[model samples]
Target: MDHNHQDPSTGLLTKEFAEGLGQFMAFASNQETTLQMGKMYCPCPICQNRRFGTVRGVWKHLYSRGFMAGYKVWYSHGETDLMVNFGSISQQNNLDEVGEQQGGVDEHIGNVQMVEDRFRVEEPKFEAQIFFDMLDAAKTPLYDGCRDGISPMSSATRMMSIKTDYNLSEDCVDAIADFVKDILPEDNLSPATYYEIHVSGLGLPYQMIDVCIDNCMIYWRRDVVRTSCRFCGKPRFQETRGKSKIPYKIMWYLPITDRLKRLYQSKHTAEAMRWHGEHESNREISHPSDAKAWKHFQSMYPSFAFERRNVYLGLSSDGFNLFGRHRRQYSLWPVIVTPYNLPPSLCMKREFLFLTILVPGPEHPKRSLDVFLQPLIYELKMLWDYGVEVYDIASKENFMMRAVLMWTINDFPAYGMLSG
Candidate 1:
């Protein structure tokens, strides 16, 4: 069961490798033509199967570079995940139990599963090629003499940061990309578009719930088929030339379960999600978990609090002026939720903040704002009453994960609206 084939102290191969290599090659050879290119995936310590090699080249690597540690399952080599019991292995190496994983999920997940194949890809053509392509791009340096941290990953992400800071249009991305292209070599990206690169694993589900023109009740749940708002009796649909009835107003809603599970999908974020329980702290209020509110809630609901993985979240919303002070024609209201489970340093980060609902307006819906929150409250109730099954990459198992809205944060006037 011990898959550590190389002795870390000496950087030498263990005796077990000599006997195991034959069996390993036999398995790889059988699956190679079907799952990979002509060359088999090299399991050498240096390449770590991130590089492919000819059978002979791979054998040479195995001899010289050494075998990577804890790869007993061979999931990368087209082995079925069900073949080996990963749960048992993960239990033996839980983040709480191991000294090796102290740094966080990113560093820990690299050893377990890298980006491209982090989640399982079933198609062969999809799996074999993408595994190496993304891995290469992720590791590639933007330019020579660049620091290890300042590479393509950093370069492109910085470009993304610029776009976000300015709230630039999609049209502007091409201009920025062209400038970077003139500088660095053509990276392993599709000329088709960079949407795939920008949002690879970040695609979450959303809904376009119909809203009344007067912003009374959202046409949701049992009211979806209704032609008018229940409270105000305002028309739900607008007249059209054809038979189609377009909604007078629409509210954008993003679901939370997938977003929560996605936190556990990444190697680093998964571990960070558990920081509320694991991080060392003092009596002086550092994280929300250390505060009186969290302790008081825990005292009342010990059963819910006992499960550290059950997420607690903060929902916050505020109105932003979309136009200049001279032309204050529009405002945008975004309802964002942040997990209380991450350590103080990460839980409140902009990247960790998820926008679950978008309310558009010529004016803020001061009184009717709660009507827009109907979908979110309904979903949160479902999450609390009946937990959802989520896969934990760090633990390598499925667990019933529940979430509760710990509190709401807003400006004074906005608080009056939400509080009422």
Candidate 2:
């Protein structure tokens, strides 16, 4: 008479419910198919060689694993419905105790049974708006190309519709914003000045005036521009003068001085700067002679002077002919410079310089003056005497050279002409 006395540990499903679930698993399994060794095959457990022999095998597997107990089963047939609650095995002991007060084991089981009149599956329905709403709340909204199933939210078709309706996603907006912020007056100064110094100090015999403007320098010999790889040192042409030679050439602009500043001012820049400054100090001592050399060079080579207040140094080569030419032919490298700081006194006094030396042939001697060699060596000596510190240097086959330098005048006499 005590309902609580029923099996308290293994709260198995009622016999009728277990049979119904077994039938459903069997029906679902029979619908799957497979391919084996170029032949199509049926995937039903009964038709395949596997441990699970039939649809009933799968149902028993699910039951032994405890998925059937206390689960809800909803069946509907044209508005006629039935809901069966199979109390979970883990909750069985408690239910048994409660059942004693309401009725016995038979009564409790009857209360949770589903009626035969309700036994149909509902068709699946899509909810598009819900998906789109979730996408709108994302931190970074999806772009247009993303609508073609390339974005994170692409799985939700409704979200793609909303993105298309708004026309708000554009790939280049962020890049343009970055560009505008960089070209501002305050952000563009340092690289402009440094670029000018490098070009002049290198004795390149060319001018680059506008550091902030992109692609300001142009190579006169389009043919020579098409040779070798500048960064990777790969040969680009079979012969310097032959049509087979690759034109090794490139166009360069000053580093984005103001753009870099704006970049640093952004939230991301702060964290990056902190890490870089801590890990590596980019500072160096400036030399006085380098400053004088630049001044003298600028005076002598007026053609190389840029009309703009700042300049940037950069290099590029015509990829087709880069490897075929000797070092001397590619000596006229482009340089970039931009301005930094303001107030003539603080900004004008700063000096930036770079040097590039191209050695011709593998056995070229130490004193060999290949093309623009004399002016470059003279500049180096002048920079050394004035106590300028060298920052970087690089050289390679067929004559490619590059160097960087910085200069400053410390404790100028009060009456000296350098004083404001």
Which is the leading candidate under lDDT? 1
- lDDT string for model 2 (207-321, tens) is 2211101111222233236334333445543356666633232222332222322322234332232221122223431422124554474456332221111121222111122
Shift of residue 119 alpha carbon in model 1, Å: 19
Residue lDDT tens for model 1, 140-249: 66566556755555555666778789998877877666655666544523222256336532245789998888887888889889998788787888878998889988
Q: Give stretches of model 1 more than 4 Å off.
A: 1-201
Scored by lDDT, model 2 comes in at 0.28
Clash count for candidate 1 is 3
Best by TM-score: 1
**Model 2 lDDT, residue 385, Cα:** 42
Q: How many steric overlaps does candidate 2 have?
A: 68
lDDT of each: 0.68, 0.28
Error of 2 at 231 (Å): 36
